[model samples]
Target: MQFNVHIGAGAVLASALAAVGVWHAYSSGWLTPAKPRAGLAINERPPEFIPTNGGVLTIAWVKAYETFEKRSPSELELKVPLGTVKVPLPFGETVSEVRTAAKYQYQVRLQKRWPIQCGDTQCVVRTGPVELAEPVAIYHGETERKTRSGWARFDKAANLEQLNRSLGLALVVRGNEPRNRDVGMREGRVEIEKFVREWMAKEAHGARRIVVLYPGEQMVDGRPVPAH
Candidate 1:
């Protein structure tokens, strides 16, 4: 077709072409993946793509925090010593009786070891079966005796908030979330499985695609995709 076009039509065509180019740039993984919170980098890899709200104390805690139990094959998850668990100290309302029990020492252990590059060749590796993460103990926090009713009321208000927090998700395009840095895999394929699992767990009434947008651009699995 060799039809001559007017200047107005030419302008519209140019604009349309530009828009198409932009759309492709967005989808071809041209844009960088979001950066996760800092200090959370495992084995020097920054994995910011995790969208979960870190359901640490939620139903998924069993899953999210279960790395300690599983045998990881990389430095993505650290086998750290001295992980803390809050233990409620029970005592009387008055301070006299509680003072006697405060002096005793309590021990807790945290363990999880992952694989890593050992040397020049594939020689770098864990020698035998997965080694256990180190265990260490620290003094528990100061004991306080609030009434069972007092704690019940506080937990009623606080625990319910935790229930809702599990439903929330975060798109950390920049910065760090050092607390869970260990969850990110270096050069590892994106955690699409986690995303899909979480989406399925929700009650979606109806939706064709679970699209996410970055900086006003629609994203397909965090990579920009064509919107229409």
Candidate 2:
């Protein structure tokens, strides 16, 4: 009978020790329930979606004008008994005027990615740069050309041909001027904002505000700060 009583006491004591150990572990967090991994919970939110349609986006178009001119000097002169007389020469001047409509494209290339930051209510997208598309479309029907010839000048045709040949390059240079680029960037900003808003409506359903930053812009205090 004593042996059985001792055995019962031993079993009770073992149970009490096990209970105390478990309580200690729980208090120390070792026995607490594990935390769910990131993005694995029952209510996990989806990632923010940004659309990059495999290539560049045409954001805006700017109109520009360029004029090319060339002049050849008259070499013929008449010498009289009293003095020398100057005569009008042919083909003395040529002018070629060109008007162009240039397209500006925006792209987020792999080398320089546009960074996008998003919150529960707003999203900010930073753009890389705005560039003029190649082969500026010239308004051929609106182009004007003029040629003048002096009675003594013989290079009128050559001068006009040269001016015409250089028109394409001149227009390209004019289209890329700082003034035109500034206009394009301003217009592009509006288009980009609109695009982002539309994208948010479809992809990031809860975002309410969209801010777009140009190459030299920044966000400060939830407002856009223009570059100096």
Q: Against the true structure, what is each candidate's TM-score?
A: 0.15, 0.62
Give lDDT tens digits, candidate 1, residues 1-228: 799956798899999999998888879979656786531233443211223343221111100211111111221222334558544443212111111011111111211331222221111111121111112111234422221223212233343343333222221211013332222221011232234335444633223233222122333443444345
In model 1, pairs of residues that clash are 26-224, 27-224, 36-48, 37-176, 37-177, 38-176, 38-177, 40-181, 79-112, 118-124
**After superposition on all CA atoms, how large is the RMSD of candidate 1?**
24.5
In terms of lDDT, model 1 sits at: 0.28
lDDT of each: 0.28, 0.64
Q: Tell me the deviation in Å of residue 110 in model 1.
A: 38
Candidate 2 lDDT by residue in tens digits, 1-228: 355534588899999999999999999988987787631334444444465644666777776655667765555445434446645324333333333343433333322233456666667677666667776676667677777666555566777788778766766677678787777777877888887777667764675788777767766676777656
Among all windows of 10 consecutive residues in model 2, the one with the lowest summed lDDT is 104-113
